[model samples]
Target chain A: EDQVTQSPEALRLQEGESSSLNCSYTVSGLRGLFWYRQDPGKGPEFLFTLYSAGEEKEKERLKATLTKKESFLHITAPKPEDSATYLCAVQPPGGTSGSRLTFGEGTQLTVNP
Target chain B: AAGVIQSPRHLIKEKRETATLKCYPIPRHDTVYWYQQGPGQDPQFLISFYEKMQSDKGSIPDRFSAQQFSDYHSELNMSSLELGDSALYFCASSLPNQPQHFGDGTRLSIL
Candidate 1:
């Protein structure tokens, strides 16, 4: 069975603090790994897509990197506005790999001022 | 300049009633997906439709079904709703093999 697990289910940080969230997966094949940010009462927003190991993508204060069995979303000097639930999902399928995204439980990030 | 759109931002229905949620994918995007998110959890893939065909289904129950229209819009139908059915349902759109965009989601409450 393919499964994705996220660490530190909930996190709290002070303004300007940097942290990294982890997502580990057990799958037959990894087509892609995705990162999303979801605010309360809204849908999960697309953040990054990592396809292979050592690959990295960045947006504003957030960065995502992938390895063979895990992915990490790093927040640098995060502000209160950056506080939201960070989700990690992986595309695991032999065919199509079209739009099916298997997601983790998400890391709830709260940046306190 | 449009994103995925969903209808009935909030809905409430009694148990055993049928509920239908709608989604409009962005123009020219051929793939759309439906996901269910429980409070304090990640979004779970409910179904994915591509090219008017059902590509995949997650661990949803038999009472849940979905359809993809010719214009790439889609609908999720739930028959005989139960208390467990209450959650936020989201619609997502993306080009084949590209990153997906999400809608605001519809919160469904089953009483």
Candidate 2:
């Protein structure tokens, strides 16, 4: 069975603190790994998409790196406005439902001012 | 840039009632996907359509049905509503093999 797991269900950090969130997955064949930031009561906003191991993507203070079995989202000097539930999802290669994604429970990050 | 659009941002229905949710994909996007997110849970894939055809299905219940139209808009028809069906329904759109763009979603509540 394909599954995505995220660790550190909740994290509280002071402004400008740095931390990393973990996402581990077990899939038949990896196609793409996606990261999204969702604010309360709103739709998820796209962040980054990692397609292969050893690949990394960055935007502003957020960086995402992927490996064979897991991925990491590293935040640097995070601000209070950057706080949101970070979601990790994985898409498997062509199958009955090729485009369907399996998502992790998400990491709730709270950056205090 | 245009984004996916969903109608009836909120809906309240009683048990055994039926409800319909609509989705309008971004212009020129040919694929549409539907997902259901329960309280405090990750979004779960329900179904998808490509070029007005049912391309794939996930854990959607038998009481629910969905279809895409000629203009690429889609609708989800759910019958026999239950409390468990109260959730946030998200509609996403993308070109084949591209990253999907999601709508704000409709919050459904059952009383």
Candidate 3:
């Protein structure tokens, strides 16, 4: 079975503080890795998709990097609005269960202003 | 720029009752996926459809069934609803090999 595990289940940071969240995974064959941010009572918003090792994508204050076994979401200078649950999901090569995302437990990040 | 849309943002049902959740995918997207999230839990995949055809299955219960229509809209029919069925149900849409965009989700509560 495809599995994803995120580290540091909960994190608290001061405004403008920088940190990184880790997501480790094991899959039969990786098709894609996705990053999402979800607020309380809201659906996940798309962040990034990493398809291969050594690949990286960046948004305003977020940068996502991928490797063979894990992915990292680095926050450059977070604000209170940046606080949310970060989720990592993996997609396997197309099959009966492929195209369906298997998500990690997620990391709850809280940034204090 | 349109995102996926889910109807009946919130629902209330009783045990043994039946409920239907609807999803309208974004334009030009031919794939749709359903996921259920319990309190304090990550979203779990339920099912998916591509071009109006069943494409993938996950941990969905036997009482739940879903289908995509010719217009790319989808519905999830859940029967014999139980308290355990109460959760946030999300619908996502995407093109092949692209990132899936999610709807705000339908909050289902069973009493």
Candidate 4:
């Protein structure tokens, strides 16, 4: 079974604090690793996709890095607006149908002003 | 820069009632996926379609069925609603081998 595990289920950070969320996964053939941010009562917003080890992507205050068995979502100098649940998901290689993502229990982040 | 669209942003139903949720994928995208998120839980994959065909399924109950239309829009039909079925239903669209774009979800409340 493909599985994704995210650590530090909840985090409270002072504004401008930096921290990294962890996502570890086990899959038969890794196809893609995805990161998303979801606010309360809202659908998840796509953040980044990592395909191979050593790959990295960045947005304004967020950076994501991928490794062979895990991924990291690094929040740099986060602001209150950046507070949201961060989700991690993985797409495995082939199945009878189209690719379906396996998601982790998200890490809830609160950036306190 | 059009995004996926979902209908009936909020719905309230009683047990044993039936409900239908709809999704319109972004133009030029051929794939659509349905997911369910319970209160305080991560989104769970329910099903997917590609080219109007059922492509993948996961954790979906037998009372729930979904399909994609020729226009690349999709519907999720759920029957015999239960309190456990109350959730936020999300629809996502994407091209083959591309990242998916999601719509603001439909919040279903079953009493």
Candidate 3 is graded, for docking, as medium
lDDT of 4 by residue, B11-52 (tens): 999999999999999899999999999888888999999888
Better model by lDDT: candidate 3 vs candidate 4: 3
On TM-score, who's better, 1 or 3?
3
Provide the DockQ value for model 1. 0.70
Error of 1 at A108 (Å): 0.7
Interface RMSD of 1: 1.4
For residue B19, model 3's alpha carbon misses the true position, in angstroms, by 0.1
TM-score of chain B of each: 0.97, 0.99, 0.99, 0.98
Count the clashes in each prediction: 0, 0, 0, 0
Tens-place lDDT digits, model 3, residues B40-91:
9999999999888889999999999999998999999999999999999999
Candidate 2, clashing residue pairs? Answer: none
DockQ-best of 1 and 2: 1
Which stretches of candidate 2 lie above 4 Å from their native place? A95-98
> Can you write out model 1's per-residue Cα lDDT over A1-113, one digit (the tens) per residue?
67999988999999999999999999888888999998999888889989999999999999999999899999999999998988898887446624578889989999999
Instruction: State which candidate, 3 or 4, has the greater DockQ.
Output: 4
Clashing pairs in 1: none
The local lDDT score (0 to 100) that residue B29 gets in candidate 3 is 92
Off by over 4 Å in 4: A95-97
Per DockQ, what order, best first? 1, 4, 3, 2
Q: Which stretches of candidate 3 lie over 4 Å from their true place?
A: A95-98
